[model samples]
Target: MAAAARLAVAGHRVAVYERSRTHGGGVGRLAREGFAFDTGPGLLHLPAVHRDLFVKTGKRPLEQCVEMTQVDPAVRHVFADGTDVALPNASRAGVVAALDAAAGPGAGERWSDLVNRGREVWDATRRPLLEEPLREDGVERLRRDPYPGAARRGLFRRAAPRTLEAVAARELKDPRLVALLESHALAYGLDPRVAPASATVLPYMEQTFGSWYVRGGLRALAYALYERCLERRVEFFFGAEAVGVVEKDGRAAGLRLADGDTAGADLVVAGVSPGRLAALAPGATGPSAVPVPPGRVSVLLALSGARPEGTVHRTVVHGDRLAELDAVFGTGAPGTGSYRPTVTVLRPDDPTTRPDDAHEAVTLTATVAPHGRVDWADDGVAAEFAERMVRAAAAAVPGLPERVLWREVRTPAHTEAETGAEGGGVPAPVLAGAGGAYLRPANTTRMPGLYLVGGFSHPGGGLAHAGMSGALVAGLVVEGADFRGSQ
Candidate 1:
């Protein structure tokens, strides 16, 4: 939608063909009996991406489209050892103080120093990895990790940590602190043990920009973008599934729809996954070495009681780190019975989410094996894992079992049915290390007039990165091949 709106404003006739009736692909909402819950991401990080989109494409800003506010005390962490700490939103001093109070002396300083190093990583790759189109030399340039190593004490020099896990153990030291650092990677389906140390930019981005929430839910933001696209005269055709890309004279000329109809276009921009793109346009080059990422399991809880005052919007209930990582990433047993998996509990204090002050809505999410790895469609399998997730969530929400009026469980099977991603895999953001294993395919493909957009392409996943992907595609389309990025 962002790309469509920008193209329309730039004097292009834009038409969006959507397989589903809705606009937002994954940013969906679940509402039952007057209670609502966000089925995708609970909070927005780095909202500036959307703000920039609104500013460039339309007259109204993002604030006018959706009521957005920073979530103070951004996230509360319930560590494995029962130690709890609430980190204030976007405040370095406040986070340092809170960590010191919760994890003993020097703990906060160590974390602060790590984030300071993360800032360096952020600066080094912000342009090449994000704002700009993926350059031809992108892979080679980003293969070298930019995270500076911790200082050596003696004369002998030590090599920098190559992975996030090594960085946490070497710098943070504390088990709770280690969990805190690794959780950021886990949230995006990245295993800390193998994820590049440059992944520290995840926490740095969240802590620096602060977490945000839109009024009603993130679905509102999607609706706003859809509306913005409509205002730009961008036409939408729902229920139109593109089965293949029509090639004419060695260039993409149109799309072959499922209903035996074709929509010819001067330029074609596909927002589907790499696998789907390959199916659409045969012989198209895909990412060289991107792994199939894990999927998310969400449990939506509708409670009978009102949201308690002073309750944090987001809470991370840390579980057994080894067990959680092994179950999700390692070649271990399928079930989560051996250890409690880490779960994130979300309780938004918005009246729109409930019938009235007498009711509350909560969402629980955890990263897990994708559909192929685990049979998410089996009722028994999904229910058992959901039960464990709820049990893990009990550590954060008081009287959670008793407060539930009803619950709904959604697994990767549901995601596969909703979106056509293979095995319901969720893509991770593009990172600058691990020999460019995490980089996504470039926006421009080998076929002329054919472009790629959305989470599966350049810049990769996350609300912010996906939005940036659209911008990059738009720039490439509007300015031709020489376009670099926004100034």
Candidate 2:
């Protein structure tokens, strides 16, 4: 991690303790029996964050480590009735063009306006929500009830409730575009109703920054980070599952293992669950340790060969309208209404989400049955789910199943047990509501000389963020750098 590596670079002795037997934690992959499968996260979008973290440590030139480009028409949205739309990565002008291409006159103009609105919302919230850490007393003092804080305080309140459905309705004037944008609700686990208006920023970010990928595999990014940690001589104790935290006089000392072994640290960084950490010490509760929300589950297909015709690095939304998409993504579980499947391809050679002319392997993901309570006692359930998803996917690009060499399904159980992902997040958080600053715990715990790092902490989630967070924590502890205030 960047934090550990940074500390070591400053000539401090550091050791990274991991519960899993491997070094790369959630962002990792291994080649086995002739198949190079990415075990965790597989895509990238914002590269600037990683660039900044890497600059702090003299690992390699950012360009030398990873290549990047823009993915035009970043995503393709297909309706159940065969209607198609593309999410272009360009500006308002581009969305207008795509809307014109798929819909018609007036539609383009509406889409342009809608994108402009989304841009406003994105600008207002990106930093406050995604970048800065929230102080508990900060939100308690808010004037509004459980809504956004920074915007109201920063003269950006006009767009405070900037949600996808609301903004799209104001812009496109057609229910279809609204549906297209709202279709993303599954990502937040909210029906357009419960989801916050601010989340429109997720799609807006994609349209603005586009998606990114690392050459060979995104998992390589994690491995590269791990190697960087090693080159700096950071000590590592793999296979040591941290079961408890050692807090003395209100300060963290180290951690107690499930096996009763203890590892001492000056700073403790837990990339694991916040709630889990709370349980480690008396009254050390955090959002992550709380009960799991009504989370959605996801399934990814790692094809040994080429994917079917219509997949892209980002989702190629294939469905009819809003209701149909709901049925697709939500239905696998009862009363869930529907599920939405966003088909994405990881083209390593093309750093952007663009398709590689010679893409050797492919990955696909879809919402499926939640893991914890589901009876997957029958492995056939995964296969059956895969078959249904493939059938639905073929509606867009036929002949996909023939290309399948081998496949694996990571249910919620798989997510928690296999990836140290906490909840249903193989790639994202389980509770979208869990976010809005407090969503992530701080890297520094209430332990003296103990620090925490990884996706679950400040800056939060994704392969790059975890690596950067690790380094950030390392810097704070080893060099006493001020990574706490703001990057």
Candidate 3:
């Protein structure tokens, strides 16, 4: 939608081909019994990215379309040791103080210092890795490992901290602190044990930009973008999945629809998984073909009681230390072990989400093994996992199980059906470290006039990154290959 809106605003004729009946592929909304739930991402970060898009495309800014509010005490963390800390949004001092109060005296200082180092990482990579078209040499520069601190030396030579787990273990000595750092990556379907140290940028970005929510739900942002696209005169084709990219004179000509029809165009912008894109065109592939990561499992709750006042919008209940991480990321499916998954409980304060003041709409999400890893189709298995997640989330919401009027489970199968991802897996955004281990498929593809956008493309996943990808593709389309990027 962002790409379409930008292209239309740039005086280019644009049309969007959507396989589903609606827009916002993964970012969707579900309404049941007067209870509304954001089926995808619950919160928005880096609102400036979308704000910039709106400002560039139309006279009305994003604020006029969707109401956005910063989520204070951005997230509440409940550790295994019963220590709870509410980290304030975009306040370094408040976060340090909260850490000091919850973890220990020096804990805050350590966290502050780590964030300071992360600031260095952010500065070094923000432009080339994010704000511009990725260059080969620029990617190589990121692969050199931009982590600021030196690795602890053993009896032999010094070894650089290669992974997120190594960085946490070496720097944040406190078990709780390590868990906190690891959780940041876990939420993105990244295995902290193998994820590059540059993944530190994840938490740094969130802490700096702050978390935000729309008035009704995060899905509102998607709707706002779709509306912006329509306002720009960008045509949309619902239930029209592009089967192949039609080529004329060796350059991309248009799209071959599933219904034996073609929509001719000068250029084609595909926002799809790398695997799906590969199937669309012969000899056309992306820069990187990384394995698809695990998808999300959300348990939507329509409770009988009212939302308590002064409750933070989001709470994370940490679970069994290393075993849980290994279970979720190590194998395709969570194995039978003492694996208690970390659960993120979301209770948006918006009245639109609930039928009335007396009702509450709650959502519980956990990054689970994707479809192949776990049999999401099995009722017994999904039910057991849902029960486990609800039990773990009880730490954040009191009487969680009993309060439910009704619960709905959305698994990877639903994700596949909606988004057409192979295993309903969600891809992690690119990180700058470990020989381009975190790199995603570049926006510009080998196929002429073909471009990629959204999570599967360069700059990687997340709502902000998706919006940025759209901008990059639009710039490439409008300003030609020489265009650097958005200002």
Candidate 4:
């Protein structure tokens, strides 16, 4: 929708062919009996991305489109040892003080120091890896780790951490602190054991930019973007599934629809997974070689009690790191052993989420193996996992199991059914280093006039990265091959 709005404003006749009857592919909402819940991401990490889209595409700004507010005490962490700490939103000093109060004196400083180094990673890659299109030499350039402060081994020598887990162990030193660092990677479906040290930017981005929530849920932002697209004269063709990219004289000329109809076009932008893209444009290579990341298991609870005042909006109930990583990456058994998997509990204070003050809506999410790796369709399997999530969330929400009026469980199978992502795998954000294993496919494909957008393309997944993907595609389309990116 961001690309559509931009292209429309650029005097191009843009038509979006959607398989579903909705605009947002993965961003969806579920409302039942006057209780509403956002089925996808509950918070917006980087609002500047959407703000930039609105500024470029329309006269009305993002603030005028949706009600967005920064979440204070950004996230409360309930560690495995029962230690709780609430990190303030975008306040380094406040976070330091809070962590000191919760853990000890040096805990805050160690965390702050790591994040400070993460700023170096962010500064080095923010433009090349994000704003600009992935250049041909991008992979080689980004393969080297940019994180500063490697521990000194011998005289005039340093041992640089290669992975996020290594960075946490070498720097943070505390078990709870390690969980805090690794949880950020787990939330994005990345295994900290293997994820690049540059992945530290994940938590850095969140802490620096602060967490935000849109009133009525993040689905509201999707609606706002859809409306922006419509206002820009971008036409929408719902239920028109594009099965193939029509090639004429070695260039993308149109799309072959599912209904045996063809829609002619001068250019084609496919926002789909690499697996699906291979089927659409045969013989064309995708952008990256990274394996499909794991998906999420969400349990939406419609509770009978009201949201208590002063309750934190988001909480992270940390679980056994080794068990979770092994289960999610398929290194071990599918079921979480005696240890509980990490679960995120969200209880928004918005009145629109409930019928009245007497009731509250809560959501629990945990990263798990994709559909191909696990049978999420089995009612018993999904039920068991949901039960575990509820149990883990009890640390954050008091009497969680008892308060539930009813619960709805969504797994990778549901994601595959809804979004058509191969195996219902959620894409992780593009990161530097680790042999370019974390890089996503370039926006421009080998096929001429055929471009890729959304989570599967350059900049990878997440709300902000996907939006940036749209912007990059738009720049490539409007400014042509030589386009460097936004200034």
Q: How well does each candidate superpose onto the true structure, as a TM-score? A: 0.98, 0.80, 0.96, 0.98
Model 4 misplacement above 4 A: 151-157, 286-288, 335-338
Give the lDDT of residue 464 in candidate 3.
Answer: 93
Candidate 1 positional error at 84, Å? 0.7
Residue 225 of model 3, lDDT score: 89
Clashing pairs in 1: none
Error of 2 at 258 (Å): 3.1
lDDT of each: 0.90, 0.55, 0.88, 0.91
lDDT of 1 at 289: 55
- Candidate that beats the other on TM-score, 1 or 2, i.e. the better one: 1
Model 4 lDDT at residue 197: 92
Residue-level lDDT tens digits of model 4 in 1-487: 8889888999999999998878899999999998999989999988999999999998999999999999997999999999999999999999989999999999999899899888989999999888999986877899887877655656663566899999999999999999999999999999999899999998899999999999999999999999999999899999888899999999999999999999999999999988889889976664446576899999999999889889999999998878778889989986545559899999999999999999999999999999877888888989998999999999999998899999999999999888889778999889999888888888898889999899888899999998999999999999998899875
Model 1 has an lDDT value of 0.90
Worst 10 residues of 4 by lDDT: 149-158
Return model 3's CA RMSD, one decimal: 2.2
